[model samples]
Target chain A: MLDYKLLDALVAVIETGGFERAGSELGLSQSAVSQRIKLLEARLGQPVLVRSPVLQATPAGQRLLNHAQQVQLLERSLSRTIPALNADRTRLRIALNADSLATWWADAIGEFCREEGLLLDLVIEDQDIGLRRMRDGDVAACLCSSDTPVAGARCVRLGQMTYRALARPDYLRQHFPEGLTPAAFRDAPAIVFGPHDQLQHRFLAQQGYHGRFPFHLCPSSEGFVRLALAGMGYGMIPDHQSLGEVKAGRLADLAPGEGIAVDLYWHYWRHGGDFMERLTTTLTRKAQGCLTV
Target chain B: MLDYKLLDALVAVIETGGFERAGSELGLSQSAVSQRIKLLEARLGQPVLVRSPVLQATPAGQRLLNHAQQVQLLERSLSRTIPALNADRTRLRIALNADSLATWWADAIGEFCREEGLLLDLVIEDQDIGLRRMRDGDVAACLCSSDTPVAGARCVRLGQMTYRALARPDYLRQHFPEGLTPAAFRDAPAIVFGPHDQLQHRFLAQQGYHGRFPFHLCPSSEGFVRLALAGMGYGMIPDHQSLGEVKAGRLADLAPGEGIAVDLYWHYWRHGGDFMERLTTTLTRKAQGCLTV
Candidate 1:
């Protein structure tokens, strides 16, 4: 069996990308980190670390690293929740899409946790990426935009998130005199969350219009929605997220008929712990009221 | 994040039902098991095992037990396969139903492992139970009767396993002079695998026949089939399993038109390594030839 301390030290080293830096971060001597690696290699009867100026993990090292990370996360959750848990108290770690996190999802989680006397650890990421974090054991549960559950996780359809192309009323009026067509979109300035975001790009690509735009890549989901509301550029936003802005006439639907419907799923580890089960039940109930489809 | 060792020790204790028994099973001294349990309880700040000569896990303990068992199995797979793995080698662990194991499943696994240069571990149980094992991380993949994949596992249709109500020809002839009827089956002796075995019961239930029988409960899948072949009582046997006996005139289909078609699914861990992927691909190919709709 691998030594827990050595595995921890190895992961720290890998994460830091250097033995000295990792040692400093972990409050250990640099030589201690190096020795731990050597001991781990000896136990496995194979070289685990490639000792360049920068530390690089070997395949064996990567395997151990992955397992170690899972173990580490599980350990953290146990320490936080198990120790504090009484019949009256619970703790939950949840991953959610930023749009949902900013919309009704957080309110639901907050209300449920408060009523149940539970602690909530919220992770905000894109819906597509949030499920992967749940799979990797980073969170106990997730709200995602996928009906198909990742293997090993139990998934229940929360409902659908309807996304409408939205922009400031003035921008749409100026850009759509001849109606929003594929040709006009090619030269239109756009606002996106980041380089990895493909929502707007996908909408364009679906219409056989592959175009590049000068983009204001706002990193924050809330900020991006705000920028779109302020007439920066056209962007796709979930109806729930843009509802207030749209109702207040700060933003208008770019193309009412050309909306995307993403089915939302609530996925969790199937271990049936109280925290996870409660969260699943609460989310399922709240989704009935929150989702449009 | 619960301590992996604590979880493992807790599960072992729960499985064995006592510290002494668990210690003996795990090759540890009773005192060591006790100390480990104490430390685990201390770390979690809660008592996991309720001790009174025999041990029982608390609800929280049971939750941890399930997670621990799953993580332990995954760790075992990682330990066994990670060292031997190369770009050219694959390691697969499959949880399979006992009926399938006795029929054509093992041969498929064997041939696939041989061809792919994969090391394979087989966890055998009933179809209903096999999927639970897959979910618990006992195996990387499984063949189950469920169309729905266990939470977190990928599911694909393997094919349909068809079963015909069968009996020794002489026994069937004697019992069904006026054709097999629900009234006659109510008093007839039946061959079933065990208390959990439901195939025969399901067949009878589907026919709206609520009947009690003097059962020859053979626990082993192979043994039950053999007992059926030896004229112990009527039983439902897979068509593939009874083919040879039927051809040899030893067994006959009691209700040829009233057969049950069980859809078998291949489910695997979503985060499974290369071995699981290769094994699933190979088994799917082999099942296409073996299973009849």
Candidate 2:
């Protein structure tokens, strides 16, 4: 059996990004934390952490981290039933994409979080790649576009978010003086969320242009809309996020009838406890009202 | 003279994350890109990149990247004057915090970008640590709270942004039912932008509490406001962002009359040419109108 005391030290180091801060978080001395790590490595017969360039978990460390998180989840659920248990408000570390957070996520889960007295540690990632966070054992669960689940995880569809190619009217007048054309797309700058985001590429390809084009890379979802409204670039913005701006005439659809619907899924450990089960129920119920079929 | 061809290959590799993508961006074959990197490495007599785990430039590679970006800036300025030269619109890579980007940045610079036909590649970072992006040669310039300039960089004050600890009225009623006290603060859940963000810590310390407390780790500035509105936790939000909500009585200040003012400064290369110079002027002049001193 592995010792959780040592695992707690490892979790602290990763979360706080250093030994000193981890020591403070765990209420242990720096040297004591270091000793615990050493003990863990000796017990495992391999190094579990990579300390140079950046402090990150080795493959072995990641598996252990996932186990620790699962155990923590179970404990929290147990505490709810047994009042004598610690009952400290537990934080669930989860990975999610920004578009959802900016649009419907907080509204969907906020009430449940408040009632359950649960705190969240949210890691923002692109929807297509967010599953890697769960695969890497860095998060207990993740909301991503992928329907496939990791080995021990289960996934459920949570509806879809529809996106339209949007731009300012003046921007269209300036860049697409002729209307949406292959030539216009080749010349007009586009706003991409990030390097990992392929929505713009997919949208452009769908429009029959697959060549190098000028683009403005704006990572924040809110900033992405701002850039479009500012006439900086045309981009794919979610319907939920741009309804008001679109109605106000601050933004207009570049392709009126053309829209892309990205399917969203909730991926969690199959054995994740009553808390996870209830939270899943809450998210599904809320997402249905806000998201499209 | 150093071979710009080799340098371009290095820059493209870092920006695009691989040799194949670099080839596509630079209009060269994959092997051509690889050979250039090898030739550059041979000339430098050391590795310019760390390929394992993640693709990032080495320290020497970073210096070269900075040099290449500076050269690109100079070339773009020259091209603007001499239109026969390549007049392709240039994308300026800059680092800035999310709060500024969400609030004043887009509005302030949107017009300038549109007029100049410039595209932006923005990197979102915390204000306190944004300078490291410039130091590491990861960006052409950055907006940060520190007035100090990196070596070969010039900085200009762009006024200050004021933040207030804010929460929903009902959240305050539930968490601080007995008025704002040290005990109440110790128990109330707080929202922190990230681990690197010290705004909440500083605000709590100012209110005379220096102990570990529960906080929701939310990285998105927009989401942070949403969480506060959803009654998840109280957090320090910029006055510009929360003004409407606060005035509408959806959210209220936890500590009235107390505000933390973070000074904003524009840091850019000293010889960054006309583009950087004009950008600095525009930011300073516009910041005065929107940001509080």
Tens-digit per-residue lDDT, B140-194, candidate 2: 8898888988998999888999999999999999899987787898788898887
Q: Which ranges in model 2 have alpha carbons more than 4 Å from their true place? A: A9-66, A127-129, B6-65, B127-129
- Tell me the tens digit of each residue's lDDT in model 2 across A58-159: 989977877887887899889978969976676788889899887888888899988888889898986544677677777888998988878889899999
User: What docking class should model 1 receive?
Assistant: incorrect
Angstrom error of the Cα, residue A255, model 1: value is 79
lDDT of 1 by residue, B75-147 (tens): 5457556755333223344566656755666445545533443433344556666676665555566777888
Name model 1 segments beyond 4 Å from true.
Answer: A1-293, B1-34, B45-95, B111-142, B194-198, B201-218, B273-275
Worst 10 residues of 2 chain A by lDDT: A126-135
Per-residue C-alpha lDDT of model 1 across residues A98-178, encoded as one tens digit per residue:
566545564455455434434343555666567766666656678777677877889888888788888888878866656
Candidate lDDT scores, in order, read: 0.65, 0.85
